[model samples]
Target: MKKKIRIKKALQYFGVPAVIDSIKAQYFGGSELFSIKLDYLEHPLSLRLLGSDVPTFKKIFIEQEYDFHTNIPPKVIVDAGANVGFTSVYLANKFPECKIISIEPEAENFEVLKLNTKPYKNIVAIQAALWNENKKINLVDPGKGSWGFTAEDSDDNDADLIDAVTVDYLLEHYKLGHIDILKIDIEGSEKEVFDDTSKWLSNVNSIVIELHERMKQGCNRSFYTGTPGFNVEWQKGENVFIARDEEVMSPR
Candidate 1:
């Protein structure tokens, strides 16, 4: 059954004790933080079920959603919408030499992200939403918990505004010559970021994005339109792995 398969995976990743603790946290615990130490990681990962972070943790650690392989080691990586720094921590361990820029917009999620990625010297956490332009935007939570915050352009006087920056701004601010791997999971806002890719698409060699067509219409259309020379290499879970046709594939 599916439940048995999930238990097997949990045992494979976290062992028997951690699995029991995870179940206790999910069912009995409320809003209390817990830490689990992974054998491959230098530090323990913090999580809470109240914010819906445990599901995200399971997707990344147990399901191995970002386990796609590459031919070369990446020099630079951009983890947009890095909720609680799970993916960033995974990548930082996978590619210790690569410089990682982890961006998260939600205040609470950003705090956890900073905590999770603080031990990794290669990761630089930034609090901002990645958009097509540099400006202020509103964070909208569609009742999908902490990992589901989406950014939208708003001119309302009392809108929950946050700093939004384009991919071009990231490159300039960090002085990154090119992005070897660009991982995007910005809820439904991929529609806005992919709407115009002229400024930073060419500088990126590969992309792994989760298109949110169900949340926002035209997300797939905009993403496909923006990526012209890139070819779909594979799809793992909800993410689509894309790489430039001419460039050598990077990021293991």
Candidate 2:
């Protein structure tokens, strides 16, 4: 497994040929806060000025073969945990007329997220964490990059408090009666969001989530149990694609 991951990493870095991307890393090709341009994409995208995030980019941009296909391109897409807005940008370009709502909690990442999606008028950016409520939550760093900032209830005094809202709140405020595509990568908080998802699960047409049971043990169960209405459309590595059998099964 380690060997395969390393091989894929090599392919994404040197093999994919971002030969023109400017780099100012701590060490050349070493993972310590390097800026990279994904000009190779339909819309050019760049990483945030944060340390050690290249691998996360590589995993989504290179290794994760998540083809955003639908019978008709998604009309409403919600990107939870939208770090740096790469996925949101891709969605916007792929679905030009679709409305995109992106949420990110980390200050540095949210700044870059806005910058990357600035050209797209269809995208709406939010700088709040999505929890099960509309309250302040402390973020815990899982340490490689801003990708692992989990919204958890805590009181360490030193930790910073940021605003959080439920998925239901997002749907209600956005007036999204039915979400065409709901992409969630909120680290390990799938447990919290899916705990009482009776209100929103039925309205979601398709869902692509990166479950963190490997990092937080009961996440897979939480997601699966909560989403009893959707079928496991497909899965690769840690990510799972789910949708209603009758409505969204045709898209895949």
Highest lDDT among the candidates is held by which one?
Answer: 1
lDDT of 1 at 139: 93
TM-score quality measure for candidate 1: 0.86
lDDT of 2 by residue, 1-252 (tens): 011123344345644332222232322444322245566555556662333345666666776445645666678889999988877887787678999999999998898888778878999999988787788889877664567778887545544788888878888998877788888899888888888888788788888889988778888888888888675478765668887763563333
Positional deviation of residue 151's Cα in model 2 after best superposition, in angstroms: 1.5
**Angstrom error at residue 37, model 1:** 0.4
- Taking all chains together, each candidate's TM-score versus the true structure is 0.86, 0.81
* lDDT tens per residue, model 1, 44-132: 99865344666688889878898766667889999999989999999999889999999999999998899999999999999999998
Q: CA lDDT of each candidate?
A: 0.84, 0.73
